[model samples]
Each structure stands twice: as structure tokens, then as C-alpha cells.
Target: MSAETPGPRRSNYSSMPVAYAAIGASSAPDLLRFPPAESTPYEETLQLGSGTERFLTAANLLMTWGAQRVAGVEVVDIDPGEPSEYPGVHFTETGTPELGAAREELFTPEGEAYLLAGTTASFVVGSKDPRRILVVTTVNESNRLGFAWGDRDEVAGYGEQQLTVEIREDSTVWAVARGFTFQSSTGITAGLKQRAHVKEAVAQAQAFLQALAPGAALRNGVAKPADEPDENDQSADDQPSA
Candidate 1:
């Protein structure tokens, strides 16, 4: 499934509900299950605060694209030139969460579930080049909130990422991030670049967890970098004065 544009690089968003390379994989809670055999896979999980309030807070933040913002990743919507031609809901370049607009335009029912299916945007991670992606799957159930995206027109490789927050029977909340990537580009530097790719992917997931609870220990037990800032720390402006 592909869409034609004026440029050389085409978009994969035209397929809507199944735009990504590995479709329907992120829809399930366990991403480890039917893995993309060719791509390298990684999973990261963190125990967020327990209870309903914590779960709701994290869900709302994720639904609003707060995780990307916290990861220092810039998300810009690609203008399809003709808005009407584009399918499903899409965000503005400002990356603002317009759930009301999505509900009204996309005919999404008014309820707690918030799945922005078929959203397309460009993500700029660090100083590296931008990677275009489409939202292929989203889970917005009573006890879970998550979305998955796939890389589009990337020169280095193709990949899919799933970021989700779930609550257990005992009300213990958890954050899970997982993804797989397969590099296609070839060159003397390609091997080194792919290694960076995995690291970046892991770091991206870690950022999502850290954003929710800075300085919180990872369930995988990976050590945090020495210079990682504790966003949970109260700034001077955040402190109350006498």
C-alpha cells in the first residue's frame, strides 16, 4: 500500500489501518510474540507508580504526545498539500494533540478510548536526520493506552515501534516499549550506523519511561547514564516561596 506525491519519496499512510510494514503486531499487549524475524528486536519496561491516578496521568500524557516531547524528539506533521486527500487523523507540525478535532472530523466516538489511527509525522531524534512515520496501531482500552508507528522512506532502514502503558489486575502500573528495525542501506559506515540505530531506539524507549518518572529504576535493571538529568527534581521556579 502506497500513496503518490509530487516528490520522489512516497508515503505509506494511504493504507490507513495497515500502513506499517509489520501490521497488527502492536495491536496486542505482548509485542514479543510474532516478531519481525529479520529485524533486531529490543524491549524495555519500567514500573510506573501504582493505582488508577498514576495510570490515568500516564495515559493522558502519552495520548497527548508528551512522551516524544519529553524525549527531546521533534515531531512535525508532513503537509500532504491536499488535506482532504489525506486519510484518517493527522497532527499539525506543532505536534499539538487535537483529540476533539480528531473525534469530530474522523467520527471517533466520544469516550475514554483515544486511538489516533493513520497519523503521519516526521520525527527528528537528536542531530540525526528526520524519519517519517505513520501511526499504524493504537490501543485505548480501560486498562491500557498505547500506539505504534512505522518508519517511512528512511534511507538507513525500516522499523516499527510500540509504546504502551498497562495496568495489572492488582493495579500495578507498567510502561512497556518495544520495537524492531532492519537496516537496508549499505556502505562502509553502514555497520557502525546500525549499531547507533539500536542504541538510539533503546534510548528513545528509556526516555519515555524517564519522562513519566525521572530517576525511576528500570525493570530491565539497566543503569542510567551518568549525565542523565532527573526531571523529577523540582526547579527553583517550581519551589514555593515564603
Candidate 2:
């Protein structure tokens, strides 16, 4: 007899309850897998501290949070204008209305991590300027932050020139300080004094963050709804109508 060829095999599988049960049994654990835990509000609050401490900590925290969150970091030493370089750092001419100075640079990985982890903004008193100055800058995001100054001779009169720092989208930060005679308003002294005020404001903001949330990431000082959902993927039925 000639050898017989085997025909195509047919699967006897059907919607058998036992087989279905077995299939479900094998897959059930997958459905039970837990989702990743989210960062707690308390933890987030702790990440963002206040004052020089907070500023430093927030800068450091940003490294892990994301690049966009960090932006940049600046530390202004408002003394009789000393040579501006941080050792392993670079600077470039920003611009000015008159005879002033401004610059910016990138942070190294160590610097980025350190700032993101936590660092304190430092201030030093300068002899030529005779004013304590604070340096302010971003932490980890990018090089798009700047500083500026303005001043007036009369204490009661408005400011003449406004010192301004601007970070363009292209990752350039600049600063300018100037003095002029203008109508009454808030006047700032173009040089060291204006720098000092900027420092003070930064310090105050830092302290506020620390006191508000010791270790939480500092939120950008932008307005947001109090009861907004944490994630956007939720369906319309999942969210309350505005």
C-alpha cells in the first residue's frame, strides 16, 4: 500500500467552559497588576522649599522633574562689577541702555543635578557699589532667563530708566540697567541698588516657597484652577463640568 498523506489538522478547540476558565485563569493576574504609584502632594510640597534654600532646592528638583521645568539659573554678585565667570561657566554680552552689564551660560550635569537637588542663592556685599546684591537665575530648564535694573535720583519720584533682563526662546538671556529723568512713579537706582532689590525679591519668593512646602517642587507662579483634574486623559464623564 502506498504511504497515505496526512490531511490538514483541525483544532477541536471550542468555547468549552473548562478551557475558557483556564484561559481566564492564566490572564486574570495581568488584570490585577497594580498601576504605578503617583507622587504624593505632601512629597511634592516638600520638594519645593522657600528663600535661598528653596531656590536652590527647587533648581535641583527640576533636574528630575523635566528639562522644561528647570529653564535656567542665575546668581548675580552685585559688587563693584567684578569679572563675570563662574569657573567651568561662560558668559556673553546681553545689552544695555547705558554703561551696565549682563550675561548668561549653561550648567554642567553636576551643576544641573546640584541645583535641581537643592542649593541656596548667595549674596555678597560689594565695596565699589556699597550694596548687598542677590544673583537670580533659573535651575535646569534652559538658558532663557534674564535680569535688568532701573533707578532714579529722587526717592519720592518715579523711575527714569528700567533695567530689564529677558531670555529669548532661542536660549539667550540678557540684562540692561539704565537711569533717566522721568515722571513720578517707582524709580530704581541703575547699578548696585537695583541689583540688590532684584536679589531681595528673589529671596522673598524663595522663603515663601520653603515655608509653604518644604520639599515640594516649586510651581511656576502661574494661575491654575484649584480643583482641576491631575491628568487630562480622563473622559468627559470623569470630570465635573466647568
Candidate 3:
């Protein structure tokens, strides 16, 4: 037990074996995950409803959808367990749902359930009628909350891809999606296609909140801002009708 004693000098056990798999695994996700095909960053801001209380509630709920796992495209299992306490509770006992299945997936679970980071999936935004799936990755709501896949999964994208919906106190909200980086002209062209779909999805989300706001035109069930002109005609109504 001497500190410097050369007792039992076993060459086999003296040096530890190199583990290539574990060592290289660190950057595996980065190599496989979605690479910036182009640099097409997108950011848009729009005024929702002007109501103080109501607007905040609606926007906040949108954020909560991700946390509670309220939204996502999931098929009902034959054994639809107990009814969820949350109204319109849609969840799957197994399998990770689409990234933005409902409005957004606020909370990312601890397990990857066997998936690649860039594995694309259809995402839906807002609770708009017919939550359609749009272009998106297979990751969860953790993106908006600034979470990454590799955090939970051993091998996942560095988690660079993201979409954020910031709801301010002023009732004006803004959204941003990290577009791809451009390496070449072909990559730029491809990135535009992806950006196009992302833009549409975010817009739908904005519209959903716009309609849900208090000042939205409840008369016709269409969400119209108070400042927005009448649908019949935005023209000068000041002149007397002929």
C-alpha cells in the first residue's frame, strides 16, 4: 500500500483502453442534425387584441400548452385512459408527438424515445381550426423555452434550430424562427422553401390569438383589431351614401 511502491505492476490493467465510440459520440448529433442550409432568419411582430387581461391570458395559455403537453398530433389509443383534466386534452402514452403538435410543446420530456435531432415532423401553431401540421423538426416545445435535445438524449442536435414566441405586456407579440445558414446558391434556394412554410405556420398562430383577443370582432366571430377598419369597406364612409 506504499504511495510510490511499484508493487503488482500489471501491464494489462495499468493503462485504460480508449473508447472511440464514447469519445466521438460527443459531436455525432452535430454532424447528423439539421445544418444551416441557408441564412434566412425570420422575425415578425403583430398586435393581437388590445384587452389587457384577456390578451395576456390567451398568449400565456399558448405558452402553457407546451408545458402541460396539451397540444401535439397524437392518435387516440384503443385504451384511452382517464379523461384528462385539461379541456381538449390530447396526449399519447407512448411516442413523442409532433414538435408543435398543439400550439407549442412547452416542456420537453427527459427521453428521446429513439430519434434523431433533425428528424423532421409536421408542426401546428396556435389552436386555430384544424391544427394543421407544418414544416418542423421532431424536437419538442423545449425549443421555444430554449432547451436542446442533446440535454436529454445522449445524441441529439446541438439544438440550434428554434422558434420563439415572445408575448410582451403591451399586448404586442413577436415571433422568431432560426433559419438555416447558406453554404451555396442551391442551399439558399432550398432554405427559402423551408422558410416559406415556417412563415405560414407562425402567421396562423398570430391569427389565432388575434381572433381570441377581447376587442376581436365577436359580432361576426372574426378577430379584428379595434383599429382595423370595417370589413365591408375601409374606404371613406364620412361621405354620405348616395
Q: Give, for candidate 1, the lowest lDDT window spanning 10 residues.
A: 1-10
Candidate 1 residue-wise lDDT, 117-233, digit = tens: 566778887898887886655665578777777776654546777888888999888888877666555689877777888787788788887665533323324343222334453
By summed lDDT, which 10 consecutive residues of candidate 2 come out lowest? Answer: 35-44
lDDT of each: 0.57, 0.24, 0.28
By TM-score, the better pick of 1 and 3 is: 1
Q: How good is model 2 by TM-score? A: 0.17
Give the root-mean-square deviation of each candidate in angstroms.
10.9, 30.5, 18.2
Clashing pairs in 1: none
Runs of candidate 3 exceeding 4 Å displacement = 1-37, 66-242
Sort by lDDT, best first: what order?
1, 3, 2
Task: Output the better candidate (1/3) by lDDT.
Answer: 1
lDDT score at residue 48, model 3, on the 0-100 scale: 37
**132: Cα error in model 1, Å:** 1.2
Arrange candidates, best TM-score first. 1, 3, 2
Tell me the tens digit of each residue's lDDT in model 2 across 1-242: 01121111122655211111111111111211311111000101123212332232223332222221222223333232222431111122321112223432334223432221111222223332222222222212232122212121223211211122223444333322222212223346444454454344444334433432321223544222222223322332211111
Q: Report the Cα lDDT for residue 96, model 1.
A: 26
**If scored against the real structure, what TM-score would every candidate get?**
0.63, 0.17, 0.29
